[model samples]
Target: MRTSANPIIADLRDRIQHLEGSVARHKAILPFGVPEIDAHLPGGGLAYGALHEFAGGGVGTVDGAAAALFAAGIAARTKGKVVWCLARPDLFAPALAQVGLHPDRVIYVEAIREEFVLESFEEALRFGGLGAVVGEVVRLPMKASRRLQLAAEGSGTIGLMIRRWRRPTEVGDFGHPTAAATRWRISVLPSEPLPVPGIGRARWLAELIRVKAGESADFVVGACDVQGRISLSSDTADGSGETRRSVHSG
Candidate 1:
């Protein structure tokens, strides 16, 4: 014998179940520009509230510059808000603008030490309104990384750590424990236009060294125009009858 109130209670439960399923589906999709990389990331792109880390190659200046460009592009597309915490005062303004991220849209926090940088990063991640926060650090402790991860999750913001090492150490080696949902190693590749002169476009080989949710690690993607625009590379014969290789990746 069902009470008269039973039907109303069952109806409310069904509505709650439907809402839960909708939220789950929304959580499962993240959109990164590159189809290949998106395929590897857990939710397609970087999850809204997760930490991602990027380690520089042996060379700091070039690698750091590239990493900044990449992070800036992601932030620009995020459309919420972006913050960049730098330990070093010399962040190339022109280079950052070239990556499609307007300089005005960024908030820069200059920190004196690595610890301060990480601490600031955690605070920013916990703030809840930013679309993404980037911190430049040499190495992050596993515990600290986990805290940033959880903070990002709680606030619905993406956190990025750019690992910069001064000396030749295995700090950015292939396998390492990090709280980052995904980790990438970025290296500069020789630009195209072989046997020619002039500053050729920069090329990068991005490796998905560690991913919390993804398949395959080794993949190559080009860092197109610095301003975050994607361009295709073409090989065409110049009027001089010379076959030169041109590089383009958008």
Candidate 2:
């Protein structure tokens, strides 16, 4: 025998699903799928509706590229458009695609001046229908960070700040307190030796410098697989083992 679903019951189920989705969007955390790393962050993942800062450990191009890849991976996980505000003319589209963030999903903005960068970030964060807003700037004051945080909260978007300074001394400026929910420093690390003679995927010393409700910590982990996934070295997941491994799986 075949029976059709009741219209009233079907309507109620749809309503329930909508409510559940609303709750998740308002209070969900995006997991990075690494238990050891998630243990150091509140809610076991990166919180939405807030600002996160990622900075290179040095002035070298490799350092900045590492940070950018990390930030891009985060954006790739989100569900909508991403606005990338930077002045760099050499952003190889292939490199971004390597981390799972395709060019079609990104809206790149070239802001030559620091002031314009801030403005663009704020604008993107305020606008609706964005997954994230990323900005590359040397200076991010407490006030500017607060604005970004509030805007993201209002729009339910994530904000990423990539700090790259011209002078070595200027790098110190990024260590100061800001309204960002979390801050990270990415440093390039040597990769594990491969069975074949070839350069492996990027490895990094990812330092969680600040978190809203967690202590700072560091981990050497593989980042941004072809699928835009990050994972902790299985040996080091418990915080007691060490092993050199490529950022991407073979």
Candidate 3:
């Protein structure tokens, strides 16, 4: 007797195999440069399919820029795919490049309106090809944040929400729901005295205000630039040393 071949069955089996491979690939998680922070987070780092928010207001612009640079460094170590969604078109490309992010690996999308910014952010997160997606938005509603969270979960990519502040209350209040895995507040620290002159070092105080896996409110992690890239500071070493090293980056 001759056997009959079913094309529908074969196609279904192929798709299932493909999906299984995808799931297996997603088991690997990306780690932020800070070990203490990563230890507090689920999966030892920022989970691939999760949304994280960076809140900034009292910190000022320098700290905000440092936060962006920090996220860029994390994305650079990834599979080399990143999308920077900004409300202003004139974002200093050179500044980002100075922080070790090659211009070629970055995609910049400029959206002037807040609504447009959030819409573009959602679209980029849904694209699924990027390793990480970052958005600088002034205000985001809980409903909208939930939608973005779902999109990130579906895409298996990291989503960074940098909340810009127009007023004092804007800094304290982020309208996101409980769905966010981690939330941070970043501010620039006063420059410490260095052995060498004319070369200034950057420092930031990152407060883990909300985290699902660990404690909530005021877990400060010191951050600084190491060889032009951002990483967590070493608690053992003094602020200024001839050689700089990152405490964690695995």
Candidate 4:
């Protein structure tokens, strides 16, 4: 196997090789750098070159913004430019910058229709040189998600699908199955208390709704900081804060 001086390129090559079945399943994983969250993942991090889904816990704008920022924070840690495909043109680039995904590093592809958004998303995933590809769509069918997953695996690029609905009724589509490796729902929570009398860091209820081979878990975490890192809530450790929950615990 050929190797590049750049570690990022090397990892990308490894992922492509793994997808071709030329090597063992040694795909690179992106750790959130939080042991509490990584402990639940199979590889102690999110697998590269895979499809993951994210959604808001409710139909409110606050929940939706939280979900978008969560995805942006994850993408910020990657190595290359990001391609964002969306049907709506309402994205605020400044808000993404606050989450560490600088607007300069992102390429926005605004399509008039959701179908075009999905098409752009899949094509970007196949391009292979991007840090990540994000698609904001209302519906993602199993077949479409499978194609996205395969494309991501082929190129070693991460694919993030944000399930957003214009109508509250469309939220029900989230219950449908997909080929994503993991599914998450984010809800805005009250910010952590401050030392004085000012606002503190934002808090979120991050729910791992599904994983490929891991149990679902819920955590109350502080919002991503300037470095795109999330800290576990201190109150949770003392049992005074919201209780963490896990489904089918062993």
Ranking by TM-score: 4, 2, 1, 3
Per-residue lDDT for 135-182 in model 3, tens only?
888777888889989888777778888777656666556644546777
Candidate 4 wrongly placed segments (more than 4 Å): 1-26, 237-243, 248-250
lDDT of 3: 0.68
Q: What stretches of model 1 exceed 4 Å from their correct place?
A: 1-30, 170-175, 194-200, 226-250
Q: What is the TM-score of each candidate against the true structure?
A: 0.76, 0.82, 0.75, 0.88
| Candidate with better TM-score, 2 vs 3 | 2
lDDT of model 3 at position 222? 42
How well does candidate 2 score on lDDT at residue 98? Answer: 91
- lDDT (tens digit, per residue) of candidate 4 on 1-250: 2445588887899888765683234378999998878988778988888998999999987898899999999999998899999988989898899989998899999999999999999999999889999999999999999999989887888899999878899999999999999999999887888889999889888899888888788888999887678878875533566546577422
Write down the TM-score for model 2. Answer: 0.82
Which regions of candidate 2 fall more than 4 Å away from where they truly are?
1-25, 234-250
Per residue, candidate 1 scores C-alpha lDDT tens digits across 1-250 of: 3798899899999999986675454353446566645666665787777888886554557876676676766776676668889788877877777777677778999999988898899999989788679898877888889999988876778887887766656454425587788777777666646577787776665666677645435443456565474332332122232222222211
lDDT of 3 at 114: 80
lDDT of 2: 0.81
Q: Rate residue 219 of model 1 by lDDT.
A: 43
Worst-scoring 10-residue span by lDDT in model 3: 241-250
Candidate 2: the clashing residue pairs are 222-247
Q: Write down the RMSD of candidate 1 (Cα, Å).
A: 7.1
lDDT of every predicted structure (CA atoms) = 0.70, 0.81, 0.68, 0.87
Error of 3 at 62 (Å): 2.4
